[model samples]
Each structure stands twice: as structure tokens, then as C-alpha cells.
Target: MEMNIIETINRFPDQSSCIAYLEGLRWQNEPECPYCKSKRSSKRHETYRHQCHGCNRSYSVLVGTIFESTKLPLTQWFLAISLILNAKKGLSARQLSRDLGVNRKTGWYLQMRIRKAMQEGEDVSLFKGIVEIDETYIGGKKANHSKKKRQARRDNKLQITGYQDKQPVIGLLERDGRIRLQVVDKAHGVTIKPIIEKTVSKDATIVTDGFGGYAGLSKIFREHQVLNKDKEQYARGKYHTNTIEGFWTLLKRGIYGQYHKISARYLQSYLDEFTFKYNHRDNRLIFDVLINKIAAVT
Candidate 1:
């Protein structure tokens, strides 16, 4: 069955249900005191506080968590997370505020906190088999420009400018499999090559455009197929960068439509969020993963 906001509400309707669920996820067996790590804990039998028999102190489940010291209802927080997970393209703070019936400032803070919970990244092993790598730029358009000039600006924005002044993103995708993306400082050989080596298995075949930076990768990989886009030859046999290029389309749409304008400093966090969601696209456990993120941060 699909896990929806209603299911979350049904599963955790109140503060007590929220506490029980969080305690279950945080502590598999006996509940320990968060302050002293004592196993001698007793339920306050009052509100959402837990009492430690050893330390003689009371604590709520929200202590030291992302939800700590928050006055909003847990139902609202769960609804916010649900909205974030359900919206494939992402939602603006104003949209969230309207949907949740909350103030715009509260909605903004809620979204930022949810993004913090979404900032979980684990060690992903290198991509094996055929890997495609590419890059793209992200920014908004300005007004007062003619239609032809706007089109030209859009065209110029597609080129993968090195990571200096703008956000230079690098995408590596295993053919018919998972993908990895990162914001980099530059696209030069020194910067891109090590990333390729670290993220791709040594024996995997690599494909890219005829960028001189990718010159020496063939010595390490089984094959380094460079489809020179300048020469107008996009593919030869099974060599192409369509997978990684496809990621750029979704990313650009999300940035332009959802975020509007992303600061260069915080671009990678959004990139991580997109990568996490996309990597787990096929898994029905995405909500579970998001919950785990909350458990970690909280």
C-alpha cells in the first residue's frame, strides 16, 4: 500500500504517538535515558516526558533532536516531510505555508529543518560497467531581453562551465543503474579525473565528450569512449552520455521551477537531496529512508 500523509496521521496522530514511534525507532529494545544513558528509566505517565530513575531528571523525546524546543505539532512536521517527499520537483516555502495552513515564516523554517534531515549521505561505492559523465549549469533568466536573446542565453547556459564563478556540477551514472552527482570547483583533468577514479570501478568502461581533461582515463579503465560533441558524433555503437544528460533536465527543472535561484554555496545540499531521492527512486522504502533521516537528525 502507498504510504501517504493520511497514513502518517493515522499512525502518529498526536504527540504521544509521535514519541512512541520515535522511541521505537531510536531505541530498539529498552529505552535509555538520553542524558545519562541509564537503563533505569520510567515513564512520567504524564505528557511526552521520560524520567530517569538514576539521574532524577525528566526529558522529552525531542531533546537534542532537530525537533528540539519546537512548539509546532508533530502532525504538522510529518505533513511537511510527506509534502517534501511527495513533491518530485520540490515545493516552495509559500506553497508549503498555504498547504499546511501555517504562517510563511514557520513554513520556511520547517522546510529548512526538513532539508537538514534530508542531508544524509553515506559512502556509495564506485559505479561499475558502462559509466556516463556530464555536467550542466543552473540559473534563472532576466527580463527585458528579446526572445532571440533569451534563447541565446539559454543555449549558452547549457555548456558545462568549470567550477569557478558558477556552480559546476558533475554527474556520473551507471548505465541502467544508479547515478552520483557533486558540485565541483573545476572540470579540469586534475579535478574531474580523481572524482572519476573514486566513484567508478577501475575496470568499468567510461564514456564522455571529447574533453581534453578526460584524456588519460583510458589507461585505467577498460575503455574510454569519447564522443566528440563538437564533431557532431553523439554516439558510436553503445557509447553515449544520455543517462547523465537526462539527470540535467530534471535538475534544471527543479532548480528553475522549485528553488528559483540557488546560492552557489548551498547548491550541493540540494544536489544531495536530488541524488538521494533519485537513487532510491525504485525502492518503496523512500519514506522509510526519510524517516530514518529524521531519526538521525532528531
Candidate 2:
């Protein structure tokens, strides 16, 4: 069934229904032993457990998934997924906590686990066609700096500036296709060029702003189109970085408006969440796709 919050709540009224739904998604009708790869299992219907005959071990559908070891009901998890998938900006932990009737910490943990599943693995194919590349900074604005910090900057004593504190994120978008985002240390050629080479195909045309880092891509790609933003030349004929810039706008708005503040330690997860949504924007059954991904995760 096409699942949304209302349908999810009505369909999965209790834990048993949730378990059955998840089991169907994960194991089809045939259960398997997670401890040992044994397909021979007998269902203990009274306890809702699977007894593996080969391994003599009992397990549930959540055995190897993000839901493993979680004490929360599958109903709550399904609700969380619905909220996360439907939220365009994002569902904050505080908001999720209030919605799920759980503590903020639990809500935070749930969101993190779901975000982990959102991560795109390294084995995915590279992007092709006209690819737009750009980089942006994430975090609070420099103008919001405290007076004392501003004074330190004027005194020329504080080597660490507000700009340095802001996280650097690089984004690559395939026209009318998927996007790849990375939390980078710096936006220099040494860092950005290699990512472009590795992620984009040799036949793909590259487009970017007037950044010196991307100047060398012409030698490697079919064509490297540069928009001299310094002179306000954003587009010339069919060449422009508007697509990637649009993605940056969405990302920054989501970061500032939805999340408000994100620590550097977990910035990549936030990136993954946004990238996953952007990549799957066209999917009519995104919720099912996410459920399938959750079931597939080791």
C-alpha cells in the first residue's frame, strides 16, 4: 500500500501489525536466521519469534537492521520514517520527540539511525551528462559574530575566524538527475578536482562558477563551462550553474530553518539526508523505497 502518516497510523495500530509489515518487507514470507545464514526457520506464532532449525537461534525481523536492539515499537519507527520522508525542510529531533511522545534524546537517536540508512554507498555509479558543480559554507553567518570575537579579529590575534568555523560543503548535480554532496575541509582544487574526477564521467560536461579550482577540468572532461559570476555573467546560451545553485539554496534553507544548528561531527549525516531526498525527489513511492533500503541495510 502507498503509505503516508495517516495510513501508517491507521494500518499499524499496534506492534504486531507493525512487526508483520516489517517482516513482510524484510523476509518476504520466509524468515531467516540473522546470526547464521540459515533459511530453515520455524515460526513461533504465539511469541512472534522465528526459531532457526539449523542454528537453533531465535530472531526477529529487526535482527540486522537499524531497528535492531531498539526498544521502541515499530509503529513509532514507521511514523518517524513517514515524517522524515514527507518533511521537505526536515523534522527536527525536538519536533519528532513531541510528535512521537518520546524523549528528545530518543527522537534524536531515531533520526540519526534513519539518516545512517540514507547514506549512499561507494559502489554507486558515477554521474554523467551535463553536471553542475558548486561549493557552499554551512552554519551561522559571520555577521552574527559576538562583539568580543569581532574585536579579536580586529586585534589580529585570533587565527581562527568565523569563516574558518563554517563548514565547507561541495555539491555536484547531474542535470535533471541526482546530486552528490560532501562535507569538505577546504574548497581548493586539490580537494574539489579529485572529487569531480572520481564522481563524474569523462564524457560529462562540467559547469561551475569562476573558481580557479575547476579551471583544470577542461583537460579531463568533454567540456568545462565556467560562469564568471564576478562580472554577473551567470548564464551564456545553454551554459549556467543555476541548477546547482538552486540545490545550494534548498540545502542552506533546510540547514538554517529546520536544523538551526548542526555540529561538525555529524554534518555529513545531515548532508546525506538532504542528498537522499534530492536524489529521490522524482520517486512516487519514496516511502516504499526508503523501507526497501532499510530492509537492505546490513
Candidate 3:
């Protein structure tokens, strides 16, 4: 069911209720041992724990999930997930700490674990139909840097250009379907072509900007349409990259306005979080979907 903050609070008022909800989702009323994969288990009536007869080990409903080692209550985890799923620009760690009454470090760690669950594995079907592909850079504008840093850049000591130092993000959006995003070192044809060839079907039409990097796409795709953005030519009837371009706008806005700064090392996790949210925008039960994803991970 679709849930709001009040509904979530009313439904899971305490730790036991939260544990029961998660157990129902994970085991369908039949508890199983995560350690030994045993169906023979007995719940301790006094506590939220199950004992496996096979392994003789005690486990909670949180076992084998992202919340496994978490010391916080399940209610807090559910509340965190609710805030994250509902926030369009994303909830910052500091804001989450204030809202959840947890220490900043605990809030940061919670969000990171949730982001880890947000990652979509590569088991999805290949994209078909007309697909729009594009690449963008993620970094602060050169003008935003200090004068000394800009001077160092001008002297060629620091690489501050769009094609250098900045993190490159490539996106492919299938019309009326899902999107795929990746962080690449370079957007050269050698790097981009293989990803397209592997993730997209050869029978699908490809739409991209007039970049030399996509010059060889015609040989692989059924139809390759290029929008000459440099010449102010955007669309040719059914040929345009505006859809994927719009996605880049949202991504950049969220990164700049919310995150402010993101390290290249963990940028992919941020991408995963955004992509998961975008792909599930229409889902009414997104909170449950995230919990199900965490359950399926192990």
C-alpha cells in the first residue's frame, strides 16, 4: 500500500510491529534461518528473535539484510527510508540526523547503507525501441573556484576543463522505459560504444547529439540520428535527445543544489540512488519496493 509519514508512524508504532512487518515481507509468515537456510525455526515469544533448529543459531528478521548489524530500531530505519523516498532533491545527512535525532555519523552511515540497497544489479533486460544517449560532467564550475586555483589551471598545472579532472557521467534512456547511468573515466567512442552495444539491442534506434564520439554508432544500431546542437538544430521529427537531456538537468540540479559537493569515489552510488528513484517515480509503493530490494540482495 502507498504510505505517507503519518500512515507509516501509525502502522509501525514500535519495534515489535516493525519486526513483524519485515518478517511478513521476508518470510511470508514462515520464518527461515538465514545462516543455515532452515525452515525449522521457532520464535522466542519474549523477544523479536528466531532460533534455527538446524544451525542452533539465533537470528532476527533483520538478518541477511542491510539492517543486519544496525543498532537502531526498525522504526527509525523505516522512517529514514520514507524520508529518502519522498524527498525529490534528496535528504542530506545532517538534515537526516536532525530529523531522526541520531548522531551525524550514524545518520550518514544509515543513508550510505540505504544507498547501497538502492543499487540495481545488472539483471535487467536490454533496452529496446528508440533510446536517447548522452554524457555530462559532474563538478563545480571553473568560475566557482578560488582565484589562485584558476590561475594554477590557466598555467596548465591543474586540469580544470570539462574534459579533464571532472567526472564523466553517461546516460541512456529508453523511450517510455527505464534508464541506465554509468560513471566513466572518458566519454570517448572506444569507451561509450561497447557499453551501448552490450546494454542496447542492435535493432533499436539510437538518438544522440552531434558528437564525434558517437560517429560509429550507425554500424551497430538500426538507425542513428544525431541532433546538431552546435548548429542550433535540435529535433528532426522523431529524432532528438531532449529526453535524456532533461534527465541530465534533474541530476545536475540535485547534485548542485542538494549535495553541493560529491567525491568521484562514491559518485556511482549517488547515481544509483537517483536512477532508482527516477525509474520508480510512478510506483505508489516505493518504500516497500526498496525494502523488497534489500531483502532480495542476499
Candidate 4:
């Protein structure tokens, strides 16, 4: 069945139904023992247990998968994955906990596990052609009590520092293709250069805003085009960081509107979820893709 939250609940009403779904996706009829990778197995008992004849070991289909040691019902996990994947912006742990009837920490943990599957490393594939690169900050305002406190102050107060209490995130997006995002410690030539070198192809033309951090990018790539936002110049011909900036809008809306706030610790996971969704925007089998990715994590 096509998996929505309702469909997940209705289709997988029990643990066995959920297990069947997992087995269908992972094993495809031939159940294998995860410990020994032996296909000789039988459905001997409950919890989808399989007796491996080759290894003489008993294991469930969930073994080594994300649902291996789960205390919650597999139904809930399927629903959560469905909800998280379908949400265009993102889903909050708090809201997810309420929906799943679990504790906030459990909901957060569930999200982290799914995000791990969605994660794409720098080695996935290189961006080619006119790739747009940009750096943005993620965080709330700083506190007024003390300069060191880092607490967000009043909304109307004049800002002393431009990027106080914020984390720097760099993005490299291929024109009408995939995007790679990273949470960097800083946005400077030394920090940004290495990332660009690894993620983008040297033959591709790079487009970005006139940020000092991108100082030496021209020397590395075939061409580095700059859009001076400071001078009211944004795009000319095929030269603009608009595509990436447009992606930033979806990301920011997801962060600010859906999540409201995110910590530096788990920010990368949020980025992973967003990047995965954005990259596969046109994929009709997105739900299945997410499920496959989750299975691959094993």
C-alpha cells in the first residue's frame, strides 16, 4: 500500500504486519541471518524469527537493521518514518512525540536514526557545471545579560554582532541538480576552500555571492562568478547564486517555521533530512527511497 501516516497505521496495524513490510523490503522473500549472512532460514517463532540452518542461529529480520532493539511497536516506527519523509518542511521531536505517544527523547532518537539513513557524505558524487555555493548562519540572537552568556535578547534591541551565537553552514548546489550542505565552524577561505575542492568538479563554473570567504575560489575552478548583493547586482546571464538561495528559503522555513530552533549538535541531521528531501524533490518513490536508505543503514 502507498504509505502515508493513515496508510501506515491502517496497513500495519500490528507488529507482524510491520515485520512483513521490513522483510519484503530487505529480504525480498529469502530471509538471511544477519550475523552469518546465510540464506538458510525458517520462520520458526514469533517476532519474525528465522532459524538459520547454515549457521544454526536464530535471528529476526530486524537484526542489524534500524529496528533491531526497538522497544516501541514497529507500527509506530513506520508511521514516524512516513510522517518525517512526507513533511516538506520537517517534523519536530516534540510534535512527533505527541503524535507517536512517546516521550520527547524517544521521538528525538527516532528522528536521529532516520536522519542517519538520509545523510549524504562529501564523497557521494561531485557537483558539476554551474554549481552555486553560499554560506549561511543558523542560530537565534544572543543574550543581553552578558556578552559571554549567549542567550537571545529582546527582538527590538539593536544587534551588536552580526553573527552572534550562530553556526556557519556552507552549501554547494548543482544547477537543477543535487545539493551538498555542511555545518562548518567558520566561513572563511581556509575553511571553505577545502570543501569546494572536494565537492565540486574543477571544470565546473562556480557561482556565489561576493563573500570574502570565497576569495581564492577563482584560482581553483574553471571560473568563479560573483553576484555582488552589496551593489544591487544579483544575476546576469547564467551567473547567479539564486538557485542555491532559493533552496535556502525551503531550508530556513523548515528550520524556523517547523522546528522553531535547532541545536548545533543535531543541526547536521536536520540538514541531512532537508538535503535528502531537496535533492530528491522530483522522486515519486521518495517514501520507498527513504525506506531503502533506512534498510541500507544496517
TM values, all candidates: 0.84, 0.93, 0.94, 0.89
Per-residue alpha-carbon lDDT of candidate 1 for residues 116-160, written as tens digits (9 for 90 to 100)? 676535466778999998876665444533578668757888532
**Model 2 poorest ten-residue lDDT run:** 156-165
Candidates 2 and 3: which is better by TM-score?
3
lDDT of 3 by residue, 54-164 (tens): 999999878778899888988999989888888787778888899999999999889899999998788888899999999999987777888977888779876665556
lDDT of 2 by residue, 150-172 (tens): 78887987665556779888899
Local error of candidate 4 at residue 283 (angstroms)? 1.2
Model 4, runs deviating above 4 Å: 1-3, 143-160
Instruction: Give lDDT tens digits, candidate 4, residues 1-298.
Output: 2357777678889998877777788888678788888898778854468898988998887777778788998888888988888888899999999999999999999999889888876557788999999999988755433644433344445555879668999999999999999999888888888988999999999998889988888888999998899999999798888888888888998999988888899899899998998888888778778877666534
The 0-to-1 C-alpha lDDT of every candidate, in the order given, reads 0.78, 0.86, 0.86, 0.84
User: Model 3: residues >4 Å from true position, as ranges?
Assistant: 146-159
Compared to the true structure, candidate 3 yields what TM-score? 0.94
- Number of clashes recorded per candidate: 1, 0, 0, 2
What is the RMSD, in Å, between candidate 4 and the native fold over all Cα? 3.6
Best by TM-score: 3
The positional error of residue 26 in candidate 4, measured at the CA in angstroms, is: 2.1
Which ten-residue region of model 3 has the weakest summed lDDT? 157-166
The 10-residue segment of model 4 with minimum total lDDT is 144-153
Name the regions of candidate 2 deviating beyond 4 angstroms: 1-3, 146-156, 159-162
Where does the lowest 10-residue lDDT sum fall in candidate 1? 158-167
Q: What is the lDDT of residue 167 in candidate 1?
A: 64
